[model samples]
Each structure stands twice: as structure tokens, then as C-alpha cells.
Target: MLIAKVYITLKKGILDPQGKAVKGALYSLGYEEVKEVRVGKYIELTFEDGDLSLLKDKVDEMCKKILTNPIIEDYTFEIVEG
Candidate 1:
């Protein structure tokens, strides 16, 4: 079996509204030590076969097509054998 882990995040020039809101709320609650915050998505997928290359391609395609918006987000993934 294989496991695929994917991470999705906003692009460098894009603003993360949710993250900013959380940071602001933290500061309001007296958490002044928090400098910055960014929110992202994590996905885990399992495949029956231990094919590293094919699994990687499948995960990458899934991220590009469904997991993230190509214009505003960036993604990376890793595949491991189980």
C-alpha cells in the first residue's frame, strides 16, 4: 500500500483572510507574541498498490484539479510505502 500526503497553501502574493482574522483575534485575546499566521489544507490518501511514481502523479493531478486553485494556491505532496 501507499500513502499520499498533500499540503495546499496560498500563493506568496495572495492574502490569507482567514489566517489574518485568526491572528487579529489572538492579539485581541492578549496573545501578542503571535507574529504571523497562515492557514492551509492537508490531505491524506491511501492507495492499494505501492507504486511510487504513479501514486505521486495521481496525487499531484488530484491537487491541481480539485484540492487547490491553481491561480491563488500552491501545493506539494509526498508518497510513501506502507
Candidate 2:
């Protein structure tokens, strides 16, 4: 089997309202040292093993097509044996 660890996040310069809200809450809760927060998505996927190159390509296609938004979000992934 193969394991994929994917992370999706907003692109730089994009406003993250959720992150800002959480940061504000943290500051109000006495966590004054907290400067900023950026919320993102983490996905773990398992799949059957095939040709390594083909598998990598397919995962990339999945990321571009369904896993992340091309306009405002970016993603990175790592593949490892499971």
C-alpha cells in the first residue's frame, strides 16, 4: 500500500478570516504571544501500489482536480510506504 499526506493552504496574500478569528480569540484568552494563525487542511490517503511514477502522477492530478483550488489555494504532498 501507499500513503499520501497532503496539505492544502491559502496562497500568500490571500485573506484568511477563520485564521484571524482564531487569533483574536487566542489573544483574548490571555495567549498574548500568539501573533498569527493560518488554517489549512491535512488529508491522508491510502491506495494500492502500482508503478511508482504513474502513482505519483495520478496523485498530482487528483490534487489539481479535486483536492485543492488552483486560484487561491496551494497544496503539497508526500508519498510513503504504508
Candidate 3:
């Protein structure tokens, strides 16, 4: 089996209101060292044995078409055998 671990995040220069809000709340709670924070998404995909090339292509396509906005977000993924 193979597991796909994906990490998605807002692109640099994009405003992340939720991250800012969380940071503010943390500061109020005495975690002042929190200089900045950014919220993102993590996704895991599990698949049976298959061609690695095809799997990578399909996952990349899915990320581009449905998982993230290419203009405002960046994503990375790794495939691990399990």
C-alpha cells in the first residue's frame, strides 16, 4: 500500500485572517512568542499497489483541480510505502 501525505498552505503575500486571529488569541493567552501563524490543510490518500507515475499524476491533478487554488495556495506531497 501507499500513502500520500499532502500539505497545503496559503501562498506568501496572501492574507490569512484565520491565522492572524489565532495568533491574536494566543497572544492574549500569554503565548507572546507567536510572531506569526498560517492556517493550511492536510490530506491523506491511501491506495493499493499501482504505478507510481500514475499515482503522482492523479494526485497532482486532484490537488490542482479541487484541493487548492493555484493562484493563492501552494501544495506539496510525499508518497510513502506502508
TM-scores, one per candidate:
0.83, 0.87, 0.88
CA lDDT scores, all candidates in order: 0.87, 0.92, 0.95
Clashes of each: 0, 0, 0
Residue lDDT tens for model 1, 1-82: 7888888899987899999999999999999999888899988888898667777777888998988999999998888776
Model 3 bad stretches (over 4 Å) = none
Q: At residue 81, what lDDT does model 1 achieve?
A: 76
Give each prediction's root-mean-square deviation over alpha carbons: 1.6, 1.3, 1.3
Question: Quick one: best lDDT, which candidate?
Answer: 3
**Model with the higher lDDT, candidate 1 or 2:** 2
Best-to-worst ranking by TM-score? 3, 2, 1
Q: So what's the TM-score on candidate 1? A: 0.83
**Considering only N, C-alpha and C atoms within 3 Å, which residue pairs clash in candidate 1?**
none
lDDT, candidate 2, 25-46, per-residue tens: 9999999899789899999989
Itemize residue pairs with steric clashes in candidate 3: none
Task: State which candidate has the highest TM-score.
Answer: 3
